[model samples]
Target: MERPIGVIDSGVGGLTVLHELKRQLPKEQFIYLGDTLRCPYGSKGEEEVIQYTWEMVNYLMKFDIKMLVIACNTATALVLEQLKQNLPIPVIGVIEPGARAAIKATQSNHVAIIGTENTIHSQAYEHALIRIKPNIDTTAVACPKFVPLIESGNFVLEEAKEIVEESLEFINHYPTIDTLILGCTHYPIIQSLIEEVVGPRVTVLSSAVETGFEVSTLLTFYNLYHANTEEIHEPAIFTTGKLHVFQRLKEDIFQLKNASLKHITLS
Candidate 1:
């Protein structure tokens, strides 16, 4: 199957996942839709998040995607199961892969998760972790400020460091937590800053890498690998909001200079 994989995110944060996907499966094509206009789905109500996520999914479905990756933690937490049940394609979410990675990295059997308000409120990561290892000690914190900061493209500034440090101060209380899961895909955008704040004592894991591996596994299991490997495939990127930041990140950060970027409206 040469059909493209569909990836949806609240914003460019999902690019972190996309980056790994492209690296791991260089021949696969992707169509990414970011609901940047309503970028921070973290604080939104449950119904609103579902509606927004469906809009993005419907938009990407036009491309005849073979699989769907819900790259936004908030949307994944609220809507992943529903998508898996409803969509014809295989649906993958960040939470489970992240939980699995955290479990593998934690030597203390204690892990901390940092994501958006809705993701934390949903207790999605906790449930996922506990489901895998019933005895795992999990601490989750909602960093309501992070998505906006990364979406603003100021993630590299000095102020970003301060905000990351402040937002993660609660980790200090969990000394037994040997691993920290960057629960939100957006958190990986500012991962270095996060690691600096959390320090070397704790290992920070991004679901992006683990998510990439999952996608690869599913592609092999489903026999969905693209038939043509000789031709270079550039992902198609779409955003519902401003294009400047998305363009910069796509080129400068993710280094997808060949990817086509466009502005589109869902409603």
Candidate 2:
């Protein structure tokens, strides 16, 4: 538990990032916290998202974590700069890496982004991409139903496919969008269906995967990489709400084994 990387998200969506992190940095130990009780920060106000994100960060800090990764896009959009300034440890968020990935993958200059209403409304991904490449054209759509569908454990079914198709009809209008950024961490869970609907020619950039790569690079740069060689280190998973749902999703959808869930109150 010494110097573990602390990763927090509004909910299980961050596990997408954490899964990649474990694969990329096999030697490092990690402690992940999901604010599942107050899930879906994407629709919340900026101030509320920031405050809740700070609470998660402060709670994780109590564990003496070496670094923090705010895996929620809403949190990143609302609070990344403030967290970087306020926290002594290095803090990272999902938006920049995802933006950079899209910038790299887009051959046509036209890119599409899908996320929660607030994330799309905030235009964080748009700003990040344009900041990196001013000429790039961006189209961001709010796929608010995607998160609820995934959380409800209904994303893999036929109805979910219909919803995915219906939701992506706008993509047909912009056939030039060769690259699509999955702005919400949760979107990656149903990425295959999305890809299928959008067709294979469009490259889907997963913020979760890109964020993991960023975390790995940052860990190397900071030299705070945990070299815990122990074959088994106790990695803790805590949820602010809905333990059974979290457990079922982790095991069934996320394929995360060997992690225990603890219920917590984030007052």
Candidate 3:
């Protein structure tokens, strides 16, 4: 069987997750839908996020994807359970994988989680971590500015430094935490800056990497792993907002070539 996996995000942020999925499961095919038209689900109302997420999922279902990955943390936090219950295929979100990885990576029970406003406010990562280990301690910070900086292509500038420093003001007090979870997909772009600010000893984990491992494990358990034939194919990337930016960043920043990205309209 050659069924593809459906990965949807509110914008280019999800590309971080999709990149990991490809690296982990090279044989599997993937269909990525980035709802850039309604980007930044973080600031949106809960009802709006839910509707946009489901619409993206519904659109991807047209491709007959075997599994669905809610690659956006905001979307994952808002709509994961509903999608799991309502959709026929397995639906995996970035939160659980990040929580699991943080638990394992932390030497101290204390861990820090940074994400968008909605994702951090939802307390999804904290809940998942606490559910896994009740005694564990968690500190979550919402860095709303990070997403906008990334979207504007200022991720590497000195402005990003100021924003990162201002955003992580809470980290100064929590010196005990040895692991920091990059809960939002967009955070990976600034992982180096985060690591620099937190010092070398503190481990920075992005959910994208862990989610790929989770996806691989689930596929193995379900026997849905793709068997690659002699020919190789490129994954298709669809962006509802700005296609050129996604394409430029994917090739220049993320180094994801061969995959053709196109502009998509939701309707």
Candidate 4:
């Protein structure tokens, strides 16, 4: 009764979610797949995004995962409901949890969201927020350069800081916004930089963290909690692109000890 949780993302961005999952539910095993070959589903069309997300779901299903977490925002925005309807296992996405967190964090009734072009365009987070609280004001900005910078391993460089500052300039004029949602999973990789740019006043939210909480709640709701409190395997990692970068981040950035990663191809 210790089937693993399946977490999928377009790339290493989902590691942020995995980090939280591990912190919150240490006893549970996880199988994380990053479709890095097709990284940045943020730029793709709705159909292509949905197709790629399904390919991920199909790939992860082979592991007999007890739960599924769509850790990628673009995929969640485009394909989550469909996956929930069709997949036998319980499925959850990062958006609703993120929106709820934003609702809880914002005291000014104003929230700002930063994500990829497609995510902001979809207005998924805005709609989710509005559905619960009709009077909230939301402003969404697309930071098109972030995902690639993060995927390329340049997110920590000074150029990335410049880009973040430039891309977020719009929020400076948005005086009322007291909360900012990192709508794209990739954004949390540079959460400090975002907080620096946004200054100390506006609270930055990581959807990954909130998603982890939601996953824990559902694990209990569905009675899918891993019974082993002692643990089993070093969480398995798979990627459809080059392994070196993912490996470096997992070891150095995340300090995931003895974790094994493999190269994978998704049809």
Candidate 5:
């Protein structure tokens, strides 16, 4: 199919998932929308998040997309089921895949999830993990500052390491939690920093990679997998904030070549 797959997030965090999607399914096209204008949806009210999430969905539906991936944990937690029930196309989220991966990787049954304030509050990962393995013990931490650091592209700085360490100090007491789920899409940008803070005992998991694999499985199940691998199409990137911000990250960090990025406004 020529139609692209739509991926949406509160900001550039979604690029982590899109990056993996590109590697896993190179033949398919992608339309990534980052709601950078009203980002850090971490602290927003549930009603506001749902409204913003729908705005992104409405915006992406403008394209001829075959599927929709809610790459933001906050959005997925708040509105994924609603989107799936209402949208015509298939809809997927990052929570389940990450929960699944953690369930398989953890030996101690105690799992740690670090995400935005809203995502942690929603207990989406906890629900998903417990649903799959009822006895799973989940400890969720709200890392409110992580998203802004990543959104500003300051993830590689020394201060970023300090922020990661400070935010993750709570995990130190819970040493039994051997598996950490990077619940926010943006968290993957600072994966190495997180790994350093958590040390070798805990295996950190990002939903980005697992989410990409989930997309692949859905594409095949829906019979939407592209037939022509030779004809590759550059993913379209859009931001409801600054085009330059998205452009720089797409170019320097994401290293996504030939991407056409534009500034857009959503009502």
Candidate 6:
């Protein structure tokens, strides 16, 4: 029960989820692995995404994690079921939590989703939404350029604003959509820009909060909550690529000054 939870993503994007989890369950420890070197899994083939995701999971399993959180939308879409069935610990994904959040936020039962190419093409959010609310109206857009822009650490520039605007132009056509789901975990890093582009009429929701809540609920159900309240927990973060941006985000964005970060390679 004291074992750390494992969170994995294609890149630093998963930190958004990790941040929420830490806030919600302050006593629990977390180990994060971001496959930054071969990131942008949104455009990769299904087989490749599955393989890469499994590699990340296999690596995390070494730490004797109590649970696994698939923080990448593409990997969640492609491999969540397999991980859930095969792994001893519970597994949760961002898509269903995100879909539920969008459904709850929408006034018209119409929602829009924007994510990586593979996630959009997989229709995972749309299906999750419709399955929960059978009559929900959903529109999905594939923003293949987002991950690269974010990974470059240039998402704060004016060019990022233009890219976000251009990528979301289609949202204007859907007047009925009162809720927009940030389908990819990385999207929340640029949530303000996305909200500006789509305007105030639509509410932008990130699955991180809901995902964190779900994690807390599961931990309690299984009695996996960390028993020691006085322990200071510093998350362990790992990435397979450059560390500059990851380090900056950890300190500046996530405010995890004491979190341990290291570069890692997977074969």
Best by lDDT: 6
Clashing pairs for predicted structure model 3, backbone only: none
Q: What's model 2's TM-score?
A: 0.94
Candidate 1 displacement at residue 102 in angstroms = 0.5
lDDT tens digits, residue span 155-196, model 6: 999999999999999987889989999989998999998988
TM-score of the candidate numbered 1? 0.98
lDDT of 3 by residue, 129-164 (tens): 999999998999888888878877768888889989
lDDT of 1 by residue, 1-267 (tens): 899999999999999999999999999999999999997999999999999999999999999999999999999999999999999999999999999999889999999989888999999999999999999998889999999999998888899888998999998898898999998888887888888899999999999999999999999999999999797699999999999998999899898999999999997
Give candidate 6's total backbone clashes: 0
Q: Report lDDT (Cα) of residue 228, candidate 3.
A: 66
Error of 3 at 225 (Å): 1.3
Which window of 10 residues has the lowest lDDT sum in candidate 1? 183-192
Q: How far is 227's C-alpha from truth in model 3 (Å)?
A: 2.8
Instruction: Give the whole-model CA lDDT for all candidates, comma-separated.
Output: 0.93, 0.85, 0.87, 0.91, 0.91, 0.93
What TM-score would you give candidate 3 relative to the actual structure? Answer: 0.96
- Which regions in candidate 2 have their CA more than 4 angstroms from the true location? 230-234
Q: Best to worst by TM-score, what's the order?
A: 6, 1, 4, 5, 3, 2
Error of 2 at 113 (Å): 0.5
Tell how far residue 200 is off in model 5, in angstroms: 0.8
Q: After superposition, how far is residue 51 of candidate 2 from its true place, in Å?
A: 1.6
Superposed by TM-score, candidate 1 places the C-alpha of residue 56 at a distance from the truth, in angstroms, of 0.5
Give lDDT tens digits, candidate 4, residues 9-119.
999999989988888888889899999999888988889998899998999999999899999999888898899899999999999999999999999999999998789
Displacement of residue 77 (Cα, Å) in model 2 is: 0.4
